[model samples]
Target: MASDLKVHSFEEVAKHNKTKDCWLIISGQVYNVTSFMDDHPGGDEVLLAATGKDATNDFEDVGHSDSAREMMEKYLIGEIDGSTVPQKRAYIPPQKAPYNPDKTSEFVIRILQFLVPLLILGLAFAVRHYTKKE
Candidate 1:
């Protein structure tokens, strides 16, 4: 469907990251989404936040239905130039030793995690108890 569309450089797309001129890249395709921002069911900020960046992951993560996908076609402006598209960095979670419930530091953190919330709850109850109407 996009066979005849002109390719746009990332630099060109990035220039449109404002409310009145927002653009987005999704799966290497560039789209002028300024008009769609206000119409977005998720609200304009979500679409605006994705402006000037590849939003394929965020788009797919939301599990948008087929109708949403079809709606996006109307906004397609061009393909992002392959050489100019930014490459995503591979994620490597920090390697940590297996969690040990018995470790002193881990035990302390676990106690704090539990006690902090419990303490807050107790304090709230105390305040409510003291402030109750006669």
Candidate 2:
């Protein structure tokens, strides 16, 4: 059955990205969804945006219904050549932000925000006390 399906390269599928001739690669299968664009519930723009790349993740993320999945069979033109498509990179945890002097200074400013007001009040009290004695 695999022999019966035409195999398309990533580049070949990318060429049909326009509104008039849209195609998509989902789960390694190439689909010429031009006819279904207007009928697509998500709208044709969603399909257009998904072009020029492997949209397997985008397609699956939407959690399409079984009926939608079945409908795709009608548009199935071929399978994408795995060798021609770039392999997705493994997920990498984000790195912590580097130590920032600005952040340290911000902390100091916050502490001063409270302490400065308290210090001024204390100084005023000290002056009042001396003036009362005079």
Candidate 3:
């Protein structure tokens, strides 16, 4: 890491939020994306929506292409001071009872899974029979 690279607090990064001065933090790196807004393939609103905040999840969720990743390099301005980066809470999915095939809903869905296809096939056959030449 270059010692000269600017380090900004989250508050400092947040100060640049505007159409003409947008900045965002992603994975603790700060970027001034104001110039890139008009050129963003997703449109300026998408970029603007993430301005002044940590957009790491939103950015990663889009699954940006390698070229897009490369493009971001040009806008790199600094990194967020490690101490200032907000710690995100870990998500824990709610526990549920183990799946039971014997459940009525599951039994009904299994029955429908089998019968719906059979019914569709039967309907197709009946339609064909009725439409056949005399």
Candidate 4:
């Protein structure tokens, strides 16, 4: 059940499928997240967790989380299960203009942490400009 609310255990997640670019069928449906395995922000660990298993709970667990789910949406494209498999659309990195803060705070925090020194340097420059006497 893609909409199931019950969270799957980590062990269950790990048993799903670990293969780098393989698709798994569950309950007559196909979920083609294989191409996204290497591109996942958390790296291969997240994709490995959902291999070879019914990943409804895993989807809930990750999407329920702020950052994980937000990141997950970037890779989602409806259900890809069955003989009517959708065309393999080229992966397009979604560009969000003005950079929405709707992304997970953890990602935001990581970015901010990386930028803090530059921010401080800018502030120092500003302070020096304002305080210098003629």
- Report clashes for each candidate as comma-separated counts: 0, 0, 0, 7
List the global CA lDDT of all models: 0.88, 0.94, 0.88, 0.56
- Model 4 residue pairs with clashes: 13-49, 16-51, 16-52, 16-53, 17-51, 17-52, 30-81
Error of 2 at 87 (Å): 3.1
lDDT of 2: 0.94
Q: Which stretches of candidate 2 lie over 4 Å from their true place?
A: 89-134
Query: Which candidate's TM-score is highest?
Result: 2
TM-scores for the candidates: 0.64, 0.66, 0.62, 0.32
In angstroms, the error of model 2 at 28 is 1.0
Q: Residue 92 of candidate 4: its Cα lDDT? A: 92
What are the per-residue Cα lDDT tens digits for candidate 2 across 1-134?
55789999999999999889999999989999999989898999999999999999999999999999999999998999999998779999999999999999999999999999999999999999989953
lDDT of 3 by residue, 26-99 (tens): 88789899998788889989988997668999999999999889888888888898787667789999999898
Candidate 4, residue 36: CA error in Å?
Answer: 0.9
- Candidate 3: where is the Cα deviation over 4 Å? 87-134
lDDT of 4 by residue, 23-105 (tens): 44333344446777676666777656656555556656554567754555444433433334333479899886776566677
- Candidate 1's residue-wise lDDT over 1-134, tens digit each? 66888899988998998888899999988888888878888988898888767888989999999998898899998999878877779999999998776797888998999999999999999999999999
**Candidate 4 error regions (>4 Å):** 1-18, 24-28, 64-134
Whole-model lDDT, model 3? 0.88
Candidate with top lDDT is 2
